[model samples]
Target: MIISAPSASEVRMSVNKSLSSRIAFIVSLLIVSVAWSGAWAAGWSPAAPMLGPRSLHSATRLANGNVLVAGGFYITTVWNFPTAAEQYNPSTNTWTSAGTLLRGRRAHTATLLQDGRVLVTGGESTTSTLAQAELYNPATNSWTEVAPMISPRAFHTAVRLQNGKVLVAGGAPVNSATNAAELYDPATNTWTAVPSMSSARKQHSAALLGDGRVLVAGGYSATTPFWSSAEVYNPATNSWSSVGSMSTARVLFPLVVLPSGKVLAVGGNSGAGLPPSVDAFDPATNTWAPVAPMGIGRYVHTATVLANGQVLAAGAYGRDSAELYAPATNTWTSAGVMSSTRGEHTATLLANGKVLVTGGSGGSGHLATADLYSPDVGSDLGSALGSGLVQADTCAATNDSTPACSAGSTAPDRSFTWTAPSSGTFTVSTTGSSFDTVLSLFDANTGAALGCNDDVSASTFQSSVAVTLTAGRQLRIVVDGYRTRCGTLTLNIQ
Candidate 1:
């Protein structure tokens, strides 16, 4: 639910249903082109390169639409992992040094906490396996060390729970796989041990299911069969149970929940080599079934769900080719190719319908290059609305909120700057979403915060705010999530 607002009454908005309907009509036209032409229009384009070559780095999209790239091995004379971090600004198409972590780390997981801070968990350094953990504040562009994990672990998986707690499970503790798990409470800045996995696993995959349970699948285990087994963790019970095993045992695969509530286990490795064999698990049935194979086999690859409901499988140990999986037909199709072959890399889906792929080892070597894959090249708001009175009815943006707004928020904010078209009152709402959202209107040019609405009368999980606009006035709208809620935002604006 949205945090309570301080205002006694809603602003002077008359609830212009007609205006909102017109905006929806405008958005429908914008997406009609997408339906006709298909989303994957443009291929790969090079973005500003990172300051240093990196591989196995963690890239987390901040609440304010910026990406944080941190902790990866770079090649100079030899491979070296640096604690330094960098921020990527999509608006400016440039990279700037964000800050530095307390210690050099690689293979760590950086999760955006419910309160907008980044919790960086265990990763290894040149000398030791790391039990150390840290927090990154985007506003301060600095890192703060937090309570360490129970043990040194790398190649582990961490997912934010529905209740704002973090669940970290399955990774090598010192040298081999461990089933040990722990919970990190952001409010307490503390960690407590939880039930371990049914099996000790490393290099596995985990995803939050629709029911709030986490499904972890196929990874290397201590015993030997390279772990084809799967398990599900129930937060309510604080335990894990064996689920249906994948048809083929594999490690280093990606487990992702689809829009249909089905979980996909994509390309990965068994004992021998990377296999293109793909599988999907139906939560409703508690069973696993093989699906269409990827065009090519890839281990250490990445799968990202597109706005169009297709999944893009990109990069592998030696392959640079990418492919897309369409659930409608249960088929795989070739996507664009990246500039460099990538393995142990990261692919993050940006709010603008593009995938941002960052540093990894490839055919050339470890890379610092970044690539933006636009499935819908014409999806940019500016392209459709162009210098207009109103933009699209619905749009997606990462909140990437500043430190100032994070005080009561677990989600980041997305800011929109526009010149007012007419002098009148306007109503902005997040009525369509299923999660709590915060809406604020602003004087964009002066950087002044205007009215803020944490919740609307219609729903606690949604927000609506009204503010008057003057012709030619510089306006900005910031949509922030109330807590740990950052995903595609179907924002409604007038």
Candidate 2:
């Protein structure tokens, strides 16, 4: 048997770009297999994978509502780091190249800045523990190295401040815990030293409080056991002060700020073994209280607060089980299990209220599999869409030819609400549709006709129409066949 992996550069390129977007699409999607119909998919079924298999990477959601996954190593016989990066679109359920990083890194921090760019900080590459820093501009889709940090550090935590700066602190794994802390200002593109923590913390957790303070808590020091000590950083004063201590010392746990503003630190290695116990810190009271324990001990897991205000704890070292924490009861219940065991992976919340879980070390090693967890999906396709897939069989048959299609166009149609991200002139097409098609645009709320077309650029039947859109414009897109026939069709806009 023959085997080969796409190089890092092969997979990272911009998608939906102007001028030959198809070429960019082909080049960028050499590894990822993004398709059109994941809405029909069920629980934990595979969505598209990334450009390649990776672990210990970071996933940050961009302002455009796309996910930026950057820099993780391949587990092909040896741990190999890659500088490549990719973006995932929840709307299309596709993966495309965001762009490569300036430095190859793993175990790093990627934080989204206020200016719609991303700040990537220190982590290990093939060469060494890196102090290198870079910024990712989504508008231009490129990376530029910024000023390196004052110290070479990895395994640190970075939280975007309320003041539009980023606070980076702690180090671990490859390096000993350091109380060193610094701030990165996007305005000046520089890093400045800040008051360090009272004690060293590595692989710790950080959360922004409602009052604009940042709470840093629990992680291994450079030596000995992990610490239960916690502290808060006040941006106004540019200082750190010791706060209430946790009941247990842990490493690699999740610190999630609930809707009520209390921070919940859950499930981690408590010096000896993984513990399911959780701790809650109330900034209002300045105290730490013990909460309920999980069904199983888990470390290196991911926790995300859902729209419904429930916290989902997923994937631990060698475990596929998941649990949900309820704030009202302060308890954990079995949520379910993933299709496979995953640790060191990422889970992102999409606008549609579904959770997207991506690459990590799974039971088979570095995972290329990704899946969606949505409360809406069911086993049957018709029941899933609530509209029987809403596809037209023929282009000219769905409507009476109103200067668009021929007189016979009628039957088989689909209605969709498209939310515009930006104000622009967009060309919507059913170019490669399976049959002759007619397209129409309508106001989603009023059902008033906005635009209609039967053919594009003197083509036979495929439809294309240009529409001017404003940000947050809600549009209703309808497509139908031109004759007494029905078939599948793919839609695109650029």
Candidate 3:
């Protein structure tokens, strides 16, 4: 997608940057895809694909636990902007048409209002930048035109304030960037002009801080050098103030608030190219500090705050690789590679804690494919199995007989709590053990047997059991030895 600028000169410069980036992306698409093809890690599984292909779209999770995805650009012989919208039901794992937008556009912003409605603001239509705005009511699954923005804008940032108003700031009207800011009050369905930002920028990132202030940072601008500067908006005074600048200037990135109330600016284009650098903003100190870089440089991607407080950054210009950031440790870990190499996609954290990644452009062109990522829960269990463990013959005294070991050993056992990563048949094996082993799986809450195994064959003492599990299901795994024998053993779950 092209970055919107306010002036003709800025527009030309922005287009040139976009074109060069696209050319480089297209040239490296195949190489990147091939490199990530077999690198898929655990916790990621294919979800139902979207009805149509799209990129630079919006995805919002509704209060009812469903997700609404709307308006984006696709490609055929030429760029095709679609007005179509759809809803995804996490309960049923299905997608249904929500409706169509009054105006088809891309590079827009959607904010979830407090009243349970979604506000969609200005974006670039097929022919021109648009000032039009609309709202989606989940109650009726319908769309209605609302008051338009103060000016035509694209690649802007919209943040829902604590008082139930949305603050939209820093976007390009047609070709040049604008510092103009506005507020949309859902209670009255009106737009009010707010104080402009200190810098004219587009493709920027904005997030609401814990203290009821909005933070805007790192965007593309024609008037500024580097564009690394940041500013904060105080709703109480209706004023904007400059804050500490990031070490790296960036655009087309994501800014997310951590559980600790710190804001993190992820990887983005830095004029020269995409940078892996990330920055964390301390609201109390009003300072920016450099954090750990990502495994790969990326832009036009999505960074989602997970239920566990970790951030999941997925996709890139043409990369399918995904990674996770742990604020507690200030480190990054590979989440996994997606099923497709995509960029400009949207990632929404569902109510169930699984992240749903939607359509985006890929090496093959616009993609309809989607993926679901299940974060590793009960990681301690995995860590325990990484090394050998000595089984205690303590279960016999407690009369634990739910697994029903054929040898009838009240052998000492170890039990661990594990949440199923996804719904499917998984093999639970005790293949590396010093003695005959018995493995059992049970519902964590109900204490009911789901599966048990005493041995895979008469020729082996190790046991293996395959059990079907539902995604997010909590269960207990009991590792015990057959008869009175107990020794060091290792467990594997796949």
Candidate 4:
């Protein structure tokens, strides 16, 4: 729900309230001086398992809010490929048969198309890498074979571009990796060759930047066993360019786009073993910086962006433990243990804010078990104010503003949490900002609107909001732009 920010007049009146009530405000603060824990009691819980045990599978959340799990290997005396697919209904927490694939495959990529259908791309079959692709129509609950890619690949990365075309990049065709890339146009149901990546990589990671460019980073190939190099694919120019390389070479990891538009590369294997290190990429500056590493070293694990903007990295090779990464604090917190150990799993964020983790290899073998994760929204909001940047235009999708103050902000925003030190009037301002700023406040616990301000006066582009808050009361302050203006800003709370 969108909450309107208070006007300048309202803010002025609040700050100028009679001093006669100062004693009462102090008393209220003392009465509630206890600190708030803001801990999340809900963590991981078992969900309905898949119809059968499998690993190296693909799980895609459909438009209908159901997860579709397709083709993977079921271990027995030998590796057995499963052609049957299943759909998970979050409403009922049950799994139902979706359909069957034209061929049994694993290590493939399943992409959700703009038309609400899922496109399953090339992967390894029982014998060799398969270039054949197929589309699953949720409305009809069936699969239809589409045009094959220009190259056969397994463990490749397929990212849906902003223009509705799917970009399929490097993967191993047989025993060696290839630099080949292609694009799938859903409108014409055809595949076209695109410029290949500078590096031949498989089991690498790729994410779409806010500016519509795809960033592909670190993987292994026959020539180069490990790669720390990174590059970007620009569809407008139909070209590839090198960007900053990661400090550590990684493979089989995941690149997640944060709310701030920065791409985060989670833990992955560095040839030696799993590395706990993590890195964040800034597209605006084309640089990579080290961030807080996870407590557990993991590779082939799944990192999912929670609804509250925190990242949850769960399971690894023979590990069932999970942890949460808070972008606001640059810290990691334990997310609790899962029911079973897994790697090569798929974690998909549900529409209702819960995360669904599906099949992967377990301690015994391939697993059919599934788990759900509920995030701690309150904990992610209580970070201390500091210097920040407004990156991606995520406010529109989140409806974080209203007509009162931030009606049409195409610019990005950053959020912080501040707790009242004592009872009385306090001022929250963006005095040393680089651009025109819009500041708004919300109750951290309940997410209720508190106050907001666009500017302090006619001559100033900075914003300030003054309100009386009780001691230990945490508030979420958002630093947004006037419209499309965004840059570096410092948040001051006094």
C-alpha lDDT score of every prediction, in listed order = 0.76, 0.75, 0.80, 0.82
User: What C-alpha root-mean-square deviation, in Å, does candidate 1 show against the real structure?
Assistant: 15.7
Report, for all candidates in order, the number of backbone clashes: 15, 23, 11, 0
Q: Distance (Å) between predicted and true CA of 73, model 4? A: 0.6
Report the CA-based lDDT of candidate 2 relative to the real structure: 0.75
Ranking by lDDT: 4, 3, 1, 2
| lDDT for residue 176 in candidate 2, whole number 0-100 | 77
Candidate 4 regions exceeding 4 Å error are 1-41, 379-494
Cα-lDDT of candidate 1: 0.76
Candidate 2 off by > 4 Å: 1-35, 38-43, 172-175, 376-494
Stretches of candidate 3 off by over 4 Å are 1-42, 379-494
What are the per-residue Cα lDDT tens digits for candidate 2 across 402-424? 32444455547655566666788
Pick by lDDT: which candidate is best? 4
Residue 412 accuracy (lDDT) in model 3? 74
- Candidate achieving higher TM-score, 2 or 3: 3
RMSD after CA superposition, every candidate: 15.7, 11.0, 17.1, 14.9
